[model samples]
Target: MKLRILGCSGGIGGDRRTTSILIDEDILIDCGTGVGNLSVEEMRKLRHVFLTHTHLDHIATLPLLVDTLFNDLHDRPLVIHALEESMEIIKQHIFNWQIWPDFFELPDKSRPSIEFQAMSAGETRELQGRTIEMIPVNHSVPGVGYRIQNDTGSFAFSGDTTTNDTLWEVLNRHDGLDMLVIECAFSNSEKQLSDLAGHYCPETLIADMSKLRHRPRVFITHLKPGEEDQTFQEITEGLRGFDVVRLHSEDHFQL
Candidate 1:
């Protein structure tokens, strides 16, 4: 399967975009501001969007995406998949008319332009030979990480999670894990803030990473805009034994 990094930064500014990943051409792992980088032609090609949580950084461009490609989606409405709680937040706060016109009601409910599908952790869905599984992760809000695999290999993304056993436990179940895109949002100096915000500083991330049995090429993502170098340097110093790299927007991988 082909994966494209639309954005990987924790916050936006400059060339950094929030957090969004495009799987192949149709599936989007998250709908962050990074999505704006895609052309209208590219947006129209998207059919399914799987959200990690209800955070604005993750779902900021979703409404805009629907609005921009509304007329082109005649074959079927775009499907937005998320955990029930996350879906509730999107329904009540985001898609609500007050914030934005409900695409589910656009043109009418019978022939709506968008649909919400609820998914549970551990559930796996296969689309055109690619396997997508949702694994629960500990975060400030209801969120999940995604594990995508095919016949060749597999990769997992830890969507905005901190120190959590469930994520590691699920990953250990797999025989082969090629890559791991995890988040370290702050530097060691911000350890207290990181803990309070349900994020990971290098200290905590390295500690939790020790629980993993498989050794995948780890790519650090979601670093704070200004603290990128400092946070990554800490990760580099701490995770000495692992194959680690920093994730950047537009990076592509075939696994």
Candidate 2:
């Protein structure tokens, strides 16, 4: 399995992008602003997108991608799987006719380019040669992260979570997790805010990492832009026993 980090920043600026990751060439973990970096051909090849939450930084580019690639769909709908609440937010706030033309209904409602499939936590959805499961995480909204495995390799991503037990329990149950793409959105100094927002700071994140039975090559993601260096430093310094590193756009890992 090839994991491509499309974007891994919490906020955007020049050279900084919001969170998104592409699994192989067919599945996208989130369609943040980073999706805009993909070439037209890459855009056309997308078949499945697993959303983390309803946050704009996580799913902002999905609507735009569907709109831009509308004509190229060729009756192929972009299947987006996420928590039912996440889908509801997209439909009500993003894909609503006025906010953006509902790609799920444009050209033709029956043959639209985007389709939202509600996935509840703990549900495993298999497609092609892969198994992708949605699992709960501690986030402000009703959000779930994804753990995907193919015959060859496995990877799990903790989507915008703070600290949680079910995530670790689920990972232990799967037992094949090779890489963990989790988020640490704030520096250790901003622990209060991080907790308030239901995101991980280095301190909280380190504690959470202790729950894992196996030490996967942990790739840290979703740090707010300006805080990158400090957050990275804290995470590296604080997490002395783990293999954690910040992720960036276009970085690829072949597992």
Candidate 3:
């Protein structure tokens, strides 16, 4: 499986995009602003979108993507897999008629351009030759992280989380965890804010990393815009004996 980092920033500016990861050509882990860069043909190739939560930064481009593909999607609706709570919030706030035409009910409710399939924590779904598992995570809103595995290798994504044991526990259960795309959204100086906001500062993230039994190549993501350097520096200084690297747009990992 090829995992492409379309965006991995907490906020966007210049070359930075939000948090969207494209798994090969068919699946998108999150539909953040980075998806906006895809061409019309690339957008049409999307078949599935898995969301972590309803946060704007994580789902900002979903509505637009549906709109862009509305006509083309009549025959085959875009499948959205997300937590029930996250799906509810998206229906109420995002895809609602007020915010954006509820694409689920547009054209025709019987066969709309989009579909929502609720996925619970610990549930695993296999598509093609890959397995996508949802694991609960600590966040302000109902959130989850995903662990995807194929014949070649496995990778885990911590959507947006703070210090949480569930994610590590689940990851530890599986061997051959090749990569872990975890988030460190704040600097060490903003440790308090990071805790309250359900995000990880460098210190907290490194502390939690100790819980992981497997030694996957750690890729840090979702660093807050202006504080990226400070957060990366702190992780480098404090995160000992781990293969950690900061993620950026256009970075591709072949697992």
Best by lDDT: 3
lDDT of 2 at 71: 89
Instruction: Give the alpha carbon lDDT tens digit for every residue of 88-114 in model 3.
Output: 899999888889999998789998999
Q: Candidates sorted by TM-score, descending order?
A: 3, 1, 2
Q: Estimate each model's TM-score.
A: 0.98, 0.97, 0.99
Off by over 4 Å in 3: none
Candidate 1 TM-score to native = 0.98
Deviation (Å) of 116 in candidate 1: 1.0
Candidate 1 per-residue lDDT over residues 120-208, each given as its tens digit? 99998888888999999988998899999989889999998888999999999989799999999999999999998888999999999
For every candidate in turn, the CA RMSD to the true structure comes to 0.9, 1.1, 0.7
lDDT of each: 0.92, 0.88, 0.93
Residue 143, candidate 2: how far off, in angstroms?
1.1
lDDT of candidate model 3 versus the reference:
0.93
The better candidate by lDDT, 1 or 2, is 1
Model 2 residue 219 distance off true place after TM-score fit, in angstroms: 0.8
**Candidate 2 residue-wise lDDT, 76-170, digit = tens:** 88888988888888899988889998787878877887877888899998988889989899899887889999998899999989899989999
Mark the 10 consecutive residues where model 1 has the least summed lDDT.
Answer: 67-76
